[model samples]
Target chain A: MTGSAAAALQVEGLWKSFGPLDVLQGIDLEVAEHEVIALIGASGSGKSTLLRCINLLETIDEGRIFIEGEEITAKGVNVDRIRRRVGIVFQSFNLFPHMRVIDNVTLGPRKVLKRPASDAEADAMRLLERFGLAEKAGQLPDRLSGGQQQRVAIVRALAMQPDLLLLDEVTSALDPELVAEVLNVIRELAAGGMTMLIATHEMGFARDIANRVCFLDAGRILEQGPPAQIFAEPREARTRQFLTRIIEAGRL
Target chain B: MTAQGGPDATSRGGPASLPGSRAQRRRDERTSALRSTLVAFLSTFVVFGVLVYIVVNSPGWPAVQASFFAPDIFWSSLPGIVAAFLVNIQLFLISEVLILALALVLAVARSSTAPVLFPVRLMATVYVDIFRALPGVLVIYILGFGIPGLNLPGVPTDPFLYAIVALTLIYSAYVSEVYRAGIASIHPSQTAAARSLGLSQPQALRYVVLPQAIRRVVPPLLNDFIGLQKDTVLVSYIGVVEIFRQSQIVEAGTFNFTPYLATALVFLVVTIPLARFTDWLVARQARRGGGASGAASQVASALGRSRGGQAAP
Candidate 1:
């Protein structure tokens, strides 16, 4: 058993269901500070649901989730405060279509953290510059290319100075040529020790960036180990089958 | 040009038409357009001319004309009716402000998802239902007369106040529904995105949801505004001396309905431009492919400019 006391994120026996279909069932995972964990799974394998539950974006049917050793899922916990420390980048690049890239980045800092607009904007500009998106600061999300928008979404999340980040299939929606740019941004974040929980279909990139790779199937984490072990010699049969399918599809 | 398709398709030039043929086709198209325009003009002229002929020949035409279209009475009553229209303008303007504010409150209440606010949502829903189900004039009469009859000391007995209140209440119910629909039209993903950013529910609604929702509903809100403007005439029943009431007084005194026609003219003059403006806004929104984005982009640019200004120093 992992030490939940010092973990950056700890989910214990988390269960979530939408109607009769159980999206997550008794899922337990723990990530140490500065750890980057990659969730690998098929389309309906509860990866997104697990990420959403950890972010408190989705209400869990049964579970206790802790972040930075605090019981975040406890009753009367202020979700806004919890979420302020945990940022999420959605698969759809759900950057506010109405807001410019800079505004999107600065929104959390200004509204949630109570940072002054100028300060938030200056920080956001610096982040955008780092992502090579400084020129797109004033453009709307729709005006950006898919990869640029996703990178802006990452920037937006990072601007909150979140202790933990949840990335849900961040590159799945991008065209092949556009995927590299978004992956590069993730690589930079991981290298800088941002402690991300990423659900991705990008096997090669996940193997490259993740400290540990977890295989989720049937709403549970079936296998987890160092990326080299999991990717090369997954122990569980389902994990082997999933890896075979991925390899057959030329994804790994 | 080579035409290899069908027998009937040979007459019209193909896509490979020479420059001369293309110019000829353009001239032909212009000629056809002009011909269609002339045909439409002549047909409209004929149709209206026959109707005028029948009306002019009718035995009651002279009497009807004198009663409703008397030139001298119309010209004399125009100034009075126009003056009274200022009262309508005030009533609607005041009522419009109240309606907008109240309707937004009601819409937010209805759209809220908190379990504790169930009673507030219920009350807002009931208020909308009751006001919408009741006729505008009935509400006006009930409030205008009924409130005063209650002998409520704080209540102003002025019918003008009731006119504004009644119109505000009735239109607020309708405008709230428009707002609710706008709120519903915005995808839940937007709320998720905002909430995930640590924004509280109210903040999300205020900053993200309401801005987009209100922009989406602007054209519809203007539609309700037009309805409220016309319904201001209904307040005359409660004894407000608006345009309709002034026209009625003139009609009663002169024993002719020409002043009513003058009132109609006033309405047409005022309402038509507003209606057309609404259409223009709707067209612009449609051309931009969605509500909120065009206005949102304008807002974005404005923010960019302001941010640029702030960043300069």
Candidate 2:
């Protein structure tokens, strides 16, 4: 908001590598307020790494990142403060297995946001209720079904009241029948105008929720456009080939 | 263990099978189990009986029995040995508490990834290496004698103090390795999930990593405590007059080695139960599939609903 011309999130010329392999090469992206961007790619196509680097969970080899127009990658920037505005739900549903569902949801707000326990719990309960996970609040994550666990993870991210949320294949690990339940939670968030950048293999879900879809191939966004354009008439051969594979696999 | 599962699986799979065959199978299993039990008992009895017979028939048997198995000397020495064991208990108790606190600090220091904490990590690594490389008694001797030998002002010359300090230093090195392994066993994603939620490294460790790590290492930690308990006798070398020293005193006074046997009995009484307890905990942890927190929290959740309330509309 401070920089009127800036998007809600921005990355310019992002480059990241792991020892001998480059994961992201010369990447640029901008996510406007309340816009949903779905990143579609193969397994090693850098989607999760991109999300991690943006959250500062992984160090970037060369890049500049901004959240709400503040240069997060600037020297001496407080990565914690930057991460506070960005919430991420992982594929594995990394809820603290040791804590109860309510505690898992409330931990961030209570510890990092400095909210009182009662205040944090109250908000967490509301989020759980909204996600239809209220009854399971007292249980540990392992007791819940995969769909339920992923939903709880989403609620945990939402508890921070983040300005932006990144979901890295959030439903990839769930049973096929359970995927819809988690996708529905994302649908509701999208309907409510929550800004999200999702990395997904869920082609149908991605097309349904994303305003814009970007197909990444070999660590680069080979093509990106409105969902209609990208899904129906991708201009790139690699995007077409990927979509054909998904269709042949009956995933789309 | 797998054989136990096999019968149940077969029984469930073919309910229409002949009742005669089923009865035959059960009888066969019972007979096999009985046969194995009898063989185990007979083998152990024969092995130990021959060993005892050799010892009792040896040329030095009478002298050894008079010196080592004198009933009167054992009974007379029993009271003193039991009393001196109290000192060992006290040393172990005090040293265990200090070791827990100090080892946790070392583990956290060595687990740190921050550039600012590099020196702390280095020092912890060095401390663990140095203490673990040297023999425990050497540490006890050097500290118990060397430090007091300095005769520095206000320094307590008590060997008890040095005994405890040396025990803590040596045991903490090993215990910290257990803690470090526990910390490392936790998958990296757990920390990432916490850090992604905006928690700082220290906060993530305190709330997420350490709680689970400490719980996972409880059995190992208690195993080390048992070792520390037995090692308390090593302080006898430093003139602390604990169990071993007391037994030595009784032996010299009475000219019999039976007091040494009595000392051994006292340690067996104290430490065997503890060793068994550690084994039970390890087995229980394995049965629960390494999620020790799951069973306790599940019980807690079932007992009370502290977080339970009406869901918001």
Candidate 3:
């Protein structure tokens, strides 16, 4: 169990780059338990890059990432172990197309955790049933709707029982009608006290559900606070400009 | 092939039904079919007829027939040629299994990005390049003569195994490229999705990449297998008495080349079944529609169509 004392995730002066492009420039943040932090920014603001650094999917150029009081970004850390604790759901809903829904959900638990097939399947069925995907357990992911596939992707991450969940534009790829279903699932997960760091463009959903909102700009968290202070009261002019553009675009 | 009263016939005949009932149509169809059959028979005869005439009229025809086409020598050579083919089959089967397993390893090694596996990657690259460049006959000569000439302890002296080693080495290099192409064809996103779930790279490959890769390459792999089966005759260059070598021995004796024809016919007999099997694999892959996603997408589209019809306003 993750203890109450430590933040679920802590990033200190994290920097990352790809060749000539500097993606993340010294990002520092700490997320408390059961916290839902909404990372709001325009396209190419390095929101996804920051989340990927936390999961160790992208090698950082500098600084360290700690999960549950232990720095996992240090050299020679067990990658699979760290990954097990930090589950990620991608924007594309990259389910193994060849596998059945139940197998997709059970794969991490069975192969990584070495759980018995019966136990894993039983647990997967419970997750699927809870997510209204029990009927799709035998079906391939290609057969599911975009919204249903995103929901299954969430269930897959939850099946690992991760200490922290990294959601990278999870609903950005869905249709307008489908976005509601995926957002509903995220809302339920938030209500269930899942610690999540979400990169999203849905300003309304972020305002409605996020415990804290952090506006990322050019690889930096320029502003962060409770949604009330951040949205209603001004902090930085840049953050205000972003909010005004979102308002003009009718996204907020 | 056209239907009765088809557009072309009806348009040209102009009120064909005026003179003919359905019974007359049937009779006309039968006559046209018989005429086409006779034309096919005569065309086949004419093609072979010219070649036979040229050959039989040649000034050296009697001597050529005595030395090359002697029917008695062909009959006598059948027993020996058939016996030697059993050896070729044995070599082909054993080497095929070894080459398939070995080539998969080489392919994976070549694809490895692990820093620690740099040496293995280099070795696999070098092996494939050298062996692929080297001729099959040269490979057999070196392994058959060279390794044994070293007189190393525990090295095989049997020509049979030496041939297997040479053939496996050469073919695995070629086959590894087929495997590499298959593996690389798989999208990187599949591996990323798998590794993101805590499966190690190798585990991801075994569970995700390989199943799809191997299935996708079954048709190509069968092609390489057939090539290997034919190349089993090259083992004779190292003094193994396989079918070709057996034919040469029979030809040297009795001063008749008909034994060569018998050997060639026997090879056709061996390869026809394998060729048919490759065709079946190709047909099955086609029917399955490309690969794994193909079948699933077909099912998905069918589901889409049925549901779309139901949901129509």
**What are the per-model DockQ values?**
0.54, 0.56, 0.24
lDDT (Cα, tens digit) per residue for candidate 3, span B106-130: 9999999999999999999999999
How high is the DockQ of candidate 3?
A: 0.24
Which residues of candidate 1, in runs, are more than 4 Å off? A1-5, B2-20, B152-154, B291-313
DockQ, ranked from best to worst: 2, 1, 3
lDDT of 1 by residue, B69-187 (tens): 99999999999999999999999899999999999999999999899999999999999999999988789999999999999788789999988889989999999999999899887
Q: What TM-score does each of the candidates earn?
A: 0.92, 0.92, 0.81
Q: Report the number of clashing residue pairs per model.
A: 0, 0, 0
lDDT (Cα, tens digit) per residue for candidate 1, span A1-252? 355357898889999999999999899999998899999999999999999999898998998999988999999999999998999999988778777788888888999999989899899999999999988888777778999999999998899899999999999899999999999999999989889999999999999999999999989999999999998888999999999999999998
lDDT tens per residue, model 3, A1-252: 235688888899999889988889999999999999999998989999998888888899999899988999999998988999999999988887767788888889989999988888888888988988888888777778999999999999988999999999999999999999899999999999999999999999999999999999998899999988888975899999999999999998
Interface RMSD of each: 3.0, 3.8, 8.2
lDDT of 2 by residue, B174-260 (tens): 999999998998888999999999999999999988877877777788899889999999999889989999999998998899999
Number of the top candidate by DockQ? 2
- TM-score of chain A as modeled in candidate 3: 0.97
**Clash list (residue pairs), candidate 3:** none
Q: Which of the predicted structures, 2 or 3, would earn the higher TM-score when compared with the native?
A: 2
